[model samples]
Target: MSHEQIQSCIEECLRCVQACNHCFDACLQEEHVAMMRECIRLDRECADLCAFAAQAMSLNSSYAKELCRLCADVCEACGNECKKHEHDHCQRCAEACFICAMACRAVAA
Candidate 1:
């Protein structure tokens, strides 16, 4: 895909990476840390994938579409996990993840 076509997805991926990272750190500081294990783990995974997907798109990699497809799946999983929690960070992360998933899906299609 052209750079222009992939720009929005790239932006969304970067936003997701930031949100996931923030949520991961915030989750660790919660009073009930044990309850946030899955969310934290998913946050890390989602952030990593989103960052990689953004990089792949920025570089115009041949596998950008595939990477984005996988990123979308991870984002959805992370969003679902985040939605389980009541913290502000988790809620924000969920919003970002869902938006990122949609952007990735559009690009992958």
Candidate 2:
């Protein structure tokens, strides 16, 4: 992949990680926390995957493409879960996850 593409992917992954964490924390504070259980779980998964993907990309790992594919899947899942909620944090996180997923997919392609 080109340097610009790698850099863009990394940036998007980092942003996704941040958004996931923020959304996860905010979900915990909601009145309907019980309903947000799946979203919280996915938020953590998405954040961890994004972080790993970014690290692999930064190191130019041979498996970076595979990792990014997994990351994109997790990001899409997280975004879908977040979209089920009406909270501001969830909305923001969903947007970030979608952006990250697209970026990762581009890099993998």
Index of the highest-TM-score prediction: 2
Per-residue lDDT of 11-70 in model 2, one digit per residue for the tens?
999999999999999999999999999999999999999999999999989999999988
Candidate 2, run of 10 with poorest lDDT: 64-73
Q: Write the per-residue lDDT of candidate 1 for residues 1-109, one digit (tens) a residue.
A: 5566599999999999999999999999999999999999999999999999999998989899999999999999999999999999999999999999999999999
Worst 10 residues of 1 by lDDT: 1-10
lDDT of 1 at 75: 100
Q: After superposition, how far is residue 49 of candidate 2 from its true place, in Å?
A: 0.5
Segments in model 2 whose C-alpha atoms lie over 4 Å from true places: none
Measured with C-alpha atoms, the lDDT of residue 95 in candidate 1 is: 100
